[model samples]
Target: MWRVWLLLVTLLGAAGAQEGKVGPQKKPSPQNAPSGAPPGAKNPCESPVLDVTPKPPPTAVLDRESASNLARSMSRLLAHQQERSAQDRAGALAPSAAALAKKVIDENNGIHAVGVGLPQINLGLLHFRHHVVIFQNNNTAYLEHYWKALALSWNHTSGVWVPPFLECNPHSTEIWLHGFAIALTVEKQRAVAGIFRPLRLDQCDSMMAKLFGGPHRCDEETTKCVSEEGRGFRRAGYRCECRDGFYNPGAPPSWRGFPGEIVELDPNDVHRCTACPEQCNTCNSAGKCGVQRDPLVRGALLATQAACMLITVMMAAIVFKQRKCKTIASGMWTILETILLGTFLLYSTVVVRFFEPSVEQCLVEPWFRELGFVVCYGAIILKLYRHLIEFRTRKAHRWVVKDVDLLKYLLAMVVAVLCYLAAFTASSLNFIREQYKLVRTEETSSGQLFLACKPLWWDYVTEAGEMLILVFGIHLSYASRNAFTQFQERRFLCAAICVEAIVSGVFYVLRAFYVTTLHPDYMYLAYFVRSQLTSTVVILLIFTPKLWYQHKQVRSLAQEFSCRLPVDAFRAGEAGALTADGDVAELNLADMNPEDIRAELKRLYTQLEVLRNKTLRADNPHISKRRGGRKVAHRRFSLQKKGSREKVRRLVSLP
Candidate 1:
């Protein structure tokens, strides 16, 4: 090896010094030298027969004139190829890696570089990083691959480039395994560690390992790493083995320290395992743990939501049917309808959350759970406060807002809420935005990943709004608790809002503090409690009594209407209707949740107010220019001065 280098160095010096001329040759080191080979094995690095060692002379490589001509010819070749045909007019074709590597080995006197190098060398025609083996006469090299083309960065020097070393013929039958292919059935990219050849897997493992104390591991992603007690070759108490039905095709003797270790060259370097082929699942390496979801839990939620929605719809229908009753429609029946809608929306949130928290589900979730509260509870609080005002103003003997006036106030409040929600949704509901999403997913350490749709950071916005409503409702409920207009309705309203506040507070607290450590409580109990609060509190406590009272009073009231009782006679006849004796002893307000007679006046007032005059024409009827207006209200009833007032007194007296 030294004799060959001496001859090349002499030629390079002589040719570089003067005008292209041969120089005086140096004496050879000896007849025989260490060629980095076994005592009897033939060194594939050198040609067996060629006198010139089968390569262009080093002097020709150094010749400046020859290099200039080579550059010009390369340019002309590119131009000529471009002009060959329109089929390749887009651009010149790229040379395949096999052709480039074969040319490299042929030019280097058949010397082959080791498995690994800096890939940058493959960029130019001067040298390459990968190994290329050419067997018999063939168009392509038998093997051309970059196993572990690596790089070195200078620690001390400011700027330096490390040149690669051509260590040995990587494909030499005695040295390396070549052209081994790994087959994968499931995961495609996990074709393992045999990819790095000259790199020695141990060195790479040490570089990337963060373990403080442990056996250096093989790549688990691509190989089946396991503990072992016996060590051999480069393995640290463990050996690399090909899976059954898969064998090392071109491995060095004894499979690089398998059960029978025959490590002839570079025995200390780590030997990596190669996969069998792409079509084989025999070597399937699974690194991920199995994940499972509990179908029973999700099914429970789905059933609960479906049941609640049905009950809410049925109750809403009953309320609409009983809308004509004064107690049922007290303080605007529209408010009850709005509350039902909001409660229905709240129930629907569970259905929206039935799926995993995807972009679409997360988007719809906020509208159902958050804005639904705004619509439902917003109506409740406003109605409670309106009741508070009505009670006070009635005690003061003053006229206050009518149903339409109250509705307009509700519209204003809703519009403001809509504005705030609109701004929030537009800015926050961007499909990808993390904030403003209603529910977020979390995972467990047991490889069981479950999405809770749990409370997020943005839930505070909606929560805060709900808190304000509940607080306002509490205050309104307390102030109106003693009102006499709607018997027991004030008490029922107070109970409903208080129950809501309690359930919401408890649900949120559990979700915040203990739900993660104790889940399915949040999924089952917490969600059920919060979602069904309206059904229990508002529907049962507030509306059920009203419906029952309407059912009881309807029969009696219908008989009175048929008899055409005068207004004054009906108002004065509560004693006769209740009992034979003119006494209040028989009527128990607490037990009966008795219907309020004065509420009948308010119901009549609403009826007359619908045909009221415009503000500017306060003394006259507010008639429209349309061809047909509410004149049916005129022809069927007297519109004479004080006629509407006299009519209302007559209707209210019937209660």
Candidate 2:
């Protein structure tokens, strides 16, 4: 124990005697060497004093930075620990003490140094090379020897960094300053007090100041300095490791902040770890929440459309074969085909929805979807309206509106829709918006997107327009309710309109909710159902009945009379058979044969003189006595004539 103290104190004395410095001298003085009892001895300390001069000025700044006591704090800690352990062991167990000492030295990586008097500090491990500056405010006022210098007195037995300076015993103020460099004694190992280093920035912290020269800095007050995970350097970094679910994005490495070094940690920041994107709990990077396109449903939509188109084609072919047959009794066969064409367009709209939204898809989808609806529904209304006109007219007039004329009405509706879409498109009223929320993360959510025809500001206008179309369809259905057709087309059309209304209502109510909560796959399913169901209803209820009736060779779907004309009535149009009776013929009100009704009307013309006399007498109040009798006769004749004429005209002008 005495020898251990003697060896360390002798080396420390040699450093000051040789250069009046704090650290070990560069050259050992053989004359100053005390007679050692050991055979093999050599100096392990580097230069006794160090020189460090600041150049240019500290210019570094940080988002969060301030002066700190890392150097003094860490150095005091190491010195206290080492000195205590040294006294505890009394230098008896060399290997164990050496191991303990090395472990303690390695604990402080970003080593800093400062003397009791120096105002400034230096960076790096507390080596003899760095010097503290105690002089007044001047960069070059550093007289290297006047400032506190770190002395490394290498105890050969314990291969570890010891305290900067130590005093063997208590001393007065006079001897304290001189003995501050190093203390020597020829006594057994005993407890020694470390020279007090002021809270002034130590060498490591000053090194930090030098490193903090740019536009970035670390907050040491809130920071923590610790050993780097795998390194032997003292004080690896100043940081607080993020908890389980959080992460520090773009944070500086452990080495950079405490000691001012750069390593990988996001963007090299010095703040506490921020939470990762909410989607990623178990991992790093953005989470997996994203829009998942409903491909399966979209594929089904395409297939359904293709099948419908095929069915539409076949129906068109079958309907074409029955073109001239009034029994299939849709308005004009050509107009009905035009309706089929419209249905084909509607079905095609389903296929177009198979792709994701983009400029082309956005534009094309609305165009196809709305235009198809306009054409199909418009054609239906026009067909009904043409028949409706006949009933809407006064008794004296007949409406034989041409098929092409009815088409013009349909074309006008289509043109109106096209203009509406064009105006919206030109104004760029459409934009992609989140259509459905696919996932919900605490911080951020993900959803599917789509191009709305009109943004929120004007979307109601579009909705209103759509509502009006359905209202008009309902109105048309009602107005034509009493206008009888051979094939109960009114009922089926009303059914189709009802279906569309239901779909529209449901879509309107659920749209807002599903847009935020439904999955994309379900969204596609809703789209397919809404698009196809109306068309399906129209096809199955209206057209399918026609197809079935036409297949069965039935001429008229009208329930009232047998479809065939009586042979007598058929011959009535061929000869003067219809006019054989110059007298008014009794009318069979149930007769659907055109010639039968015409024959009756022609016979009524032959009684025009008699019918006129009765009508005049009945309408004249002056002849009150016989007016009742004449009115009864006139009423009977007038009803017969009107009914006969209506039947004849309707049957003859059916196309």
Across 275-385, the per-residue lDDT of candidate 2 in tens digits comes to 545644432323223344556767767787799899989888877887755445445777667767778887776677566544565556667767777777777767667
Worst 10 residues of 2 by lDDT: 169-178
Off by over 4 Å in 2: 1-288, 328-330, 429-459, 553-655
Cα deviation at 199, candidate 1, in Å, is 41
TM-score of each: 0.42, 0.41
TM-score: model 1 vs. ground truth: 0.42
Number of clashing pairs, model 2? 25
How does model 2 score by TM-score?
Answer: 0.41
**Candidate 2, residue 75: lDDT:** 34
Give per-candidate clash totals: 4, 25
lDDT of 1 by residue, 86-116 (tens): 2342123223323433443445332333211
Task: Identify the runs in model 1 with alpha carbons over 4 angstroms from their true place.
Answer: 1-291, 393-396, 429-441, 445-447, 452-455, 520-525, 554-655
Model 2, CA-based lDDT? 0.46
